[model samples]
Every structure is written in structure tokens, then in C-alpha cells.
Target: MRKLVCVAAMLSLGVTQVTFSADLAGAKDHPLVSRFRGADAVGYGQADFGNARLPSGANGKHTDAAGRLTDIVYRAPPGKRAAEVFENYRQALAGAGFAISWQCGPGTRDDGCGGFRFAGDLADPVIATLKGDSSEMIKLLDATNNNVSYLIATLVKNGQTSTVALMVSQDDERPTGVLLRVIDAAPMAQGQVTVDAAAMAKGLAAEGKITLYGLHFATDSATLTPDSKQTLDEMAKALKAAPALKVYIVGHTDNTGALAHNEKLSQDRAAAVVKALTTTYGIAANRLAAKGLASYSPVAANTSEPGKAKNRRVEMVAQ
Candidate 1:
């Protein structure tokens, strides 16, 4: 027969068995500190360049210039002390051309450095992780002096600035933990409304409401950007073309803070737009009603940057 019997190799008396090692839990490290070892990753995330607030000095905070952010949380190998991990990271950062900005550690008064106050949907998970059965770890958090250690450093490379925060703490039981947040300042989403007044009018005429994208604003503020002039002029033209048309100006925001805060911000922004249309564009104040919808009426999902951008907008609704 064409098929022959296959013989399997017999085990030798002196043969050794080969085994492969498994990766440690959360072992991945960010590229900035890939050389340092001993900790396993427990959490990781990234966002396109955005503002980061870092502890400045005692009882103060500094806002980093906009940049990409890479956040990582790691659990230290057993027997690794918090102080040891902090010092090691400090040295490593310095060696990598980073200048120390601020540091808080044991023996320092509680100044609220290195602690994070998460907002919006991100709060529950972060709070649970920080507060769960780990009294020692909680005490070691930024702003507490229960043996917590944290460092902030700045690095400038290729005409771009980057900031890093390394906070370390110990758990009550086995493994210690470290939170590493890095922000690399880089170009991000451009704030400019490209849609003209005709398009806005057409959309409103057909859909009863039109979302405006070109109304730019400063971060966390209602002040309109100078570049918003084009969009504003177009909106004015549309209002002039339909003198009898009354519309409701609605402002919206992304889900990034407490519901109340976001609602108030949206209201303020809507009022600002109404004021601009009246004073700057000569649109009659009575023809426009301002309202803030906050994040309740979203046109897209809130899980991604594009969705968040879409949600942060102003709409003209025919009344």
C-alpha cells in the first residue's frame, strides 16, 4: 500500500522537556519608559493631544500645553516598595532628558499632588479601584502623606514638549502600584467651521434643525475663537434673508464632567452665541431663544473622539 506506517519517536531516558514562560499580568510598558521593568500593566489608555493638569507647587496646579496623552497603571512585583519605584522612575526620566517640575513624597505635607479627580463616566471605575479594600494604597494617593511618592517632569524634543507624571503607592497586602501618565504636546483637531450660511439655512429648511460645526471656542470657555467670524457672518446672512423666522439656539457639550456642570456650560455657551448674534451680527434678540441641551441629546456615540467632537456643537432649531 502507498500509505506506510508512521513511527513516533520514543522518549529518551536523558531527554529534557522544553517549556515557555508566560507573560506577566499587565506587563506592557509605554514606549517612553519601556526600559524600566518589574511592574505589570493593569490599565492603559491614549487620547489625541489634549490639555493635562499637573501639580505645580504646594497647593497649586499647572496646565500642560495640549498634547497626546498616554496613561498607564501598573502593579509592582511583590516586595517592591513605593519609594524604590519612585526613585527608579525619577532617575530614568532624568536620564532621558526630562527636567523635574515638581515632586511630592513621604514627609511632605498633603498638597494634592499626583491625585486624579476623574469626572463624568470615568469616575466610578477609577474611584472603585482606588478605594477598594486598600486603605494603605488610598493613604498613599496624591495629596495624602501615608507614604505616597510622585514626580512630574518635562521634556522638550524636536520642538515639541512632553510632560510625565509618575505616582507610586503600596497596597496593604502584596503588590505595590504605580500610575504613569504622559502627555506629548502635538497638533490635534483644528477648530474651524467650514459650513457656510447657505448650507446652514438649507439644512434648517429641510431638517427643521441644523448643526453648526464652525463655531470655535476656547477650551472650557464660551469665548468664541476669532476664526469663527466666517461662520458667524454666514449665520447673520441667513438670519437677514429670513427676517420673520424665529429660531431656538441650542448648545451642546461632550460628557466630560458632572451633569450639572456640563449643563451649565452648555447654557452659558448657548447664551454666548445668542449674544453674539444679537450684538455682533445685528440679529434681533427676540428672534432667537437660547437653550442648553448639555449631553442629553447626542447625535453620535460618546466612546470616541470623533463622537465627542460631534456632540460638542451648536444647532439652530426652527421654532
Candidate 2:
């Protein structure tokens, strides 16, 4: 059988027993993270490249990353406990050079993980996992909301990081089900992820705000690249087309490093845009207000470069 993910090392941990069955049609393992031995995959879904919002730490914190996301719902053979399945994954992940970022099992907390709000926060993942190959095999799929065993682990290899989260359920009416999801950081193909002036004008007219990704800057610096002139020229044209329009030139950044530093950098980037508009593009200074949201307002997650790329953008909000 062609298995996905590298869990062969799990055998050394006394998980040597093996059983085989057909996984759901068009479903398979993650190819980098494996399932518990003899576990039948009841649900499987994959995104070659996309964003994932995984609940982290207590108190509703979340880790939103963009990359290849693979979610698998596996049910172990009879006579297995959810805790055992969760423990097997922990050891296997550790053996595979992964570090546990956060973990919680039943009876290990005060307000319960219910305070973490995984159910409410991660409704998307739940919905995605449930719909792939029918939800009947997985039952309620309530592990996220229930006080179940769960853990998040990360592995950094060759300068890229891969994260995996496991949630195990111990429902009396169902077999032990493991929700395994893995995401690895990858660069999104650079293309026209940005909009042109025509689209920008339409967006502003429709939504009162338009997010722009055309402005270029170096790492941790606010200076615009030479290629940014084209985007600026387009912006200038847009502003000229709407002579009475007043807008807020807001700067945003990805969630990285110290929050205060990003705040200052974002402000500087916004100011740079304003300077170019007034001094070079002939936009009046009074018509534009520059504000910095830093990482506070992100269009995407900051966990991966692609997500961060989307987050680090400027916006024009009608003023």
C-alpha cells in the first residue's frame, strides 16, 4: 500500500502491529505524516497550497499559515483508546524531529480548552474535513469542541517549517478518531496577485477601501523599489480621475518580530507613500491621511511567507 507521511519509525515505539484496509476513495495519508497503525481513513482532504487557521494556545489564539494543507480523519482498530493514539503521534513526531508547540489533554486545564474556542475559531477546518467522503464515518467530529486530547508540533527542515496538529476523540459511540492536519511553509508563485488601477478604483467604489499589493519594499525597510513607480503612476492616475476623493493611506505588515517595531515600520512605509504621492505624483497632502496598522490588520496569516506577503500591503480607505 502507498502510505503518505513518514511514520515507519512509529513501529519502534511498540506500534509494530499493522493492518490494512481501503481508505476512502481518492483519499490517502498526508505523504509526510502517517496515521496510527491499522487506522482506516474515513475522511481525507488536501489543498496543494492554501491557508490554514489552526487554534493554538488557550484563550482563542490561532496560528494561521499558508501552504499545503492535508487533513485526514482516521479511525483506529477496535480496542484502542484515544489517549494511546494521541501518544503514538506525539512520540512519532518527536522521533521525526518535531517540537511540541502546544498540547492539552483532558483534566489538564481550568476553564477547559473550551475557553480556547477551537470549535468556533476553526469552523472552516471542521467543515472541510467533514465533507470529504461523507461525515458518517467520523460521527459528530466534535473533537475540536469537546475536552479531547490535542497537540500541535512543528518541524524545521532545510529552512522550511512544517506544522502538524492532531486531535483525538474518545466518544463512547464511536471508534477512536484522529484528526491529523499538516501544513508546510512554501512560497506562493509570484504573479499578478496585485490589482491594477482600474480594479483598484472599482474596489474603492464598491467597498470604500481597497487593499494594494503593488508597493515594493525590502525586508524591514520602507523604501519603494524602482519597479514600484508603475504602481504609483497608476495610483496617481486613479487619484486624478477622482479629483474630490479623499482617502486614508494605511500601511500594514505581517505579524513578525516585535509588535512595536512593526508599528513604527508600517508608519514609515505609509509616510513614504504619502511623500511620493504629494511630492512626485501631485496629490495634495491634505487629501490623504497616513496611518499604520502594523500587523494588527492582516489580510492573510503571518505564519508562512506567502501568507505574510498578503498581509504586508497598503490600503486606500475612503475618508
Candidate 3:
């Protein structure tokens, strides 16, 4: 069950469907630093963190019912120094089998970068432990309204892992270190699970005006799971709510299938999604464009089943 949930999330990441063009090794620093500069600073901690400090937060949103925050955080200074911290964190967590989910805050939503929103759905607790000596799992609690973000790095080791989430607020404004407080108190879910849409798009918006819909899926398969449809429905509401903005439907997949097959699948699925939007949901097709990617690009790994799942996915890029 744990493996299935992990596979589902990896599939949601789009590892099985599309490929990437740019090598994202150095894309983490600037965007994260920028986000740190823009948020409200509640407290400051030592810039140099050799040891992991547990964070705490209220259980209402950023935590589970038991009040534990299950997210992983890595702090670094601005500029190259921060990247070094990121690298160290990457190595440590990767040594344990995790994949970093590269993310950026709202201020840096350029092409190829994941925009900031809530850390709600991105947080996946250990549904079931597999091939590990440790039973402890990592999760990012709710930061729906707290506007700080960074280049999030997730890791998966032997089907058991934690994410190395890196964030930098604009001007280096940091949040209260309440993440650990919640983690210590969170009650475990009963089974291996995938994050849902409410958690994924809690605070997401488009063009600083329209609220964006985040519909994520695994690569290759165009079948919209219940979670994927929920996310799309949320966006559909946003489209209905704000009728002026146009959206581009971007389709992506992992590096597993043949390039031609991947491109076709991405295109067909994207067009299908647009079709659903226009014909079924009443959104205009003119508001959408289908872009297909063959398996040359990736935000995670193509080596493992979980990583490949993360690689295959579709996203709505802003117009």
C-alpha cells in the first residue's frame, strides 16, 4: 500500500510521461532567495544549520489532527552560500533515497519554474514504510496563507524517504520555526496516501489576479484520478469566477517511453484535457493550448519507479 501511494505521487509528478530540456541543477537559488525577501519575518535563526531543528506550528492547517507538522525544511543564506546549503541537504537526504521537488514562490513564476502556493498537497506523509529501518515519515504541514517559499527538494529512498524542502523569502524574511512542533504531534494516517488538490492549490493564483487551478497527474496515463479531477474542478471554479484570464494547458511526461510516443501522449492528453474543459466544463478552448514534451526533460528522477512517476505529469502554465 505504501509503495502504491508513493507510485501514485510519483506518477502525479509525471515521471512516466514527459521529458525536459533544461538541466535544473542550478535553478534553486535565486527564486528561493527572492521569496524569502518578500514575506513577513516572524523570527530569525542561525544562518548556519549543521543540525536539523524540528519546526512547530498550529495543527489547524499546517499540521495533522494531532497537531504535528510533518514537513522538512532546509535554510540557507542568500546567493551561492544558500545553494551550498541546498547541495548539502540534497546529499544528506538523497543518501536516504529522496527526490527534491523543485519549487519557487509566486514572485518568480517564470517559464520552467514551479510557482509558490500552499504546501498543503505537496506534503505526503509516510503511508506505509518499506525497506527502511526507520518508521518516521516526513510531511509539510499547512502554510496556506503564510507566504514564504523556496526550491523544494523531495527525496525517496528504498521506497521510504523525506523531502528536502528549500525556501527563501524575499529579503530573507523567515517564519516561526513551528514545523517541528507540529511534526511531534501529528497523528499518522491509516494507509499509504497521495496528496489531494485542496492541499495542492490552497493559496495558488495566476497573474497575481486569477486563482490558478492545479491539475496534477502521473505520466502517460490520461485518466484523471479523483484527486486530479478535484484540482481541475477547483480551477474550473476559478475560471468561472474570473472569466477574463486565459490559460495555457501544458502537457509533460517522463523519460521512459519512446520520444515520439511521449510527444503524442502528451499532446493527445493535453488536447483531451482542453476538450474536457471546453466541452464538458464550459471553458473556452481559446483559453487553452496543448504543448507536448517527449522524454528529454524531468524535474525528478527517471531511474526509479517513483521518480519516473513524478516525471510524467501535466501543468497549467500562465499566459
Candidate 4:
């Protein structure tokens, strides 16, 4: 079993980037005010709580600029409290006209993990809302990689509203990671979280079990055949109908190659299915987990070519 790494230190980097429909010209302003152009003429004020290293040479330096109510950059070191950093920014923005409409950070779960091993603390994203009642919702974006963090706040004053955001990031050369964006919790005029409940029902139909079918592979290799696309198409249909339903996509192999190699090949095949689902069908990043089972979980005999073909398959178990 792959032991879970300690992630307590990841709490310090809790925040993600906020992208606009168009790049805001005043994004670098001291207080960071952004305007949604054209018919979307609404302007927003922002605050970033990411523990990213800024030019301050220390943590919690507040600077004032045009459009920015207050800009505070905090570089919290290991063994330090990020709440202290957030308090400083709170004070600065308070001096201005903004008050905390919402705030979010790592929870008790992040306490014992120690320090972060990845960037952005990207795995943990929390949203606090002052709806009719004050409530907080925390979401995890990626499980395999848990180093990214982000937070977003929406403050309202009379008829005007502004949004503040912060994100901490670390460099990972490969573009395979999770990203979270917080949407304001407003009463829906129609839909329930824009979720198609019927679709969700279809997705839950195959919750924990994986099914199989016979398919040929390349000689001496685990590479899938062109005919395998038919099975993949069925999997894609199930995913598309229920967009929010996430699954643990697994690949299994027959006992032909060495166990280690078979395991690796199975894992690769599983991930390939995930890529096709996400990129080709526009599935969200947080909804897929990929793994390889090797030949240990085979359902058929390796004695016959027909039986072995039945053992090589891609299986999905809803997470």
C-alpha cells in the first residue's frame, strides 16, 4: 500500500488564483480592483491571502495603490501560523472600507500532516458564506497531488459588490494538477447547483463495481487494440450524462508480462482513459482518479488467448 504523506504544513498555502473573463488592467493596483468590461461593467476589489513570497523580504507587508484598498503580502515560514498573516491583511483592509464578507483556510485535517510537499496547497479550497446564515464549504481538488491551495471571498456593500482572492502555487513541470474556483452562493432562480439530478442518478448506477469484456491486445504488449474504442465509448457516455459523478478509473492486465511491468501498463492505460474523458468530454479536474491493478485481479484464465483477452480491461468504480 502507498502510505499517505503528512500534509499539515500545507495549510499555510491555502488559496487559488481567480481568473476573469478578461484580464483586469488594474490587477497590480495596490488594492487590486478589477472591472468586468462591456455589459459586464461590474467592478470588483480583491485581496490575496496566498502565502506566496512577495518583494516584502518578510511576511505581512501592507501596501496601498490605486484601485487597491490594501495589498498585504505575507511569506509565512515553516512552523509559523498563517492566521497571524491573515489577521494583518484583515486590519489593512479594515482601515479601508472593506470588511470580511467571507474567509477560508485549512481545517483540523491539515493540522497533523506537517509541511507541504507540493505547491499551491492546491488540494484544499474552502469557501465561507454569509448566506441567510453563515456557513462554510470546503472542497478537495486533487488527491494524488495535494500541494496547491486557494481561497476566494465576495464582499457586498449596499448595491456594489467586490471579490477578493488569493492563491499559492509551486512549480510542477507537468500540467497535470487540480484547480478550484469559488462561485458566489446566490439563490438560484431555477436549477439546483446547476446539477442535473437525473444525470447524477445514472452515474450512481455503477457505484463500486467494475464490469469487463473481451478485447485483444498487441502481441507481447499491453497496448489496447483499435477495437477497444467501442468499450471506451460506453464509458464516456456514462460519464457525460452525469457530469459531477467522479470515478476511480482502473486498468487490469492478464498474467503475461512481469508483475511490475503489468502493473505499470495497467496504470498507464487507466490514466489514458481519464485523459480522454477530461480533455475530450470536458469533465472537471476534480472528478477522476486513475490506477493500475496489474494481473493480480484477473477474472479469467491466462491459459487460453480468449480467456486472457477477457482479463484485460478498463474498469470504473465511482468514488
Measured over all alpha carbons after superposition, the RMSD of each candidate to the real structure, in angstroms, is 16.2, 7.1, 19.7, 22.1
Q: Which residue window of length 10 is worst by lDDT in model 2? A: 10-19
1-319: candidate 1 lDDT, tens digit per residue: 1110110111112333221122233334445554125445555556676555565555445544456877656666667677677777777677678889888765333333334331211222332433133333333343233455667888776676778876666545546566677777664575543777788789889999888887878888889888878878888899999899899989999898899988988998888889999998899999999999899999877765556778999988999
Error of 3 at 33 (Å): 48
Report the C-alpha displacement of residue 56, candidate 4, in angstroms.
Answer: 83
Clashes of each: 5, 4, 65, 21
Estimate TM-scores for all models. Answer: 0.49, 0.61, 0.36, 0.33
The deviation in Å at residue 161 for candidate 2 is 2.3
By lDDT: ranked, best first? 2, 1, 4, 3
Which of the two, 1 or 2, has more lDDT?
Answer: 2
The pairs that clash in candidate 1 are 26-41, 49-67, 49-68, 67-185, 193-214
Q: Rate the local accuracy (lDDT) of all candidates.
A: 0.65, 0.73, 0.39, 0.42
Q: Is candidate 1 or candidate 4 better by lDDT?
A: 1
Q: Model 2, residue 45: what's the lDDT? A: 75
Indicate the residue-level lDDT of 259 in model 4: 92
lDDT (Cα, 0-100) at 85 in candidate 1: 71
lDDT tens digits, residue span 1-319, model 3: 0010122233222244221122122112110111122122121122111212211121212211222223222222224233333334334434434444443332321211233233323322221211111111221123333433444333333443333334422222322211111112122321133334343233335223222224443434665545556556666775676577676666777776688888888787777778778887899878778777756557666654444555666666556
Superposed model 3: Cα runs more than 4 Å off: 1-227
Instruction: Report the lDDT of model 3 for residue 288.
Output: 75
Worst 10 residues of 3 by lDDT: 177-186
Best of the candidates, lDDT:
2
Model 4, 1-319: lDDT tens digits are: 1111111111122333334343233322222232111111112233321111211111223211112132212222233233333344444444445444433333222321223322223222122211111110122222223333333344444444444444332222322111222222221121112223344345458446455342335654555566656555666666777777778877888898699888888888777777766786677768899889988887867764444655776667788
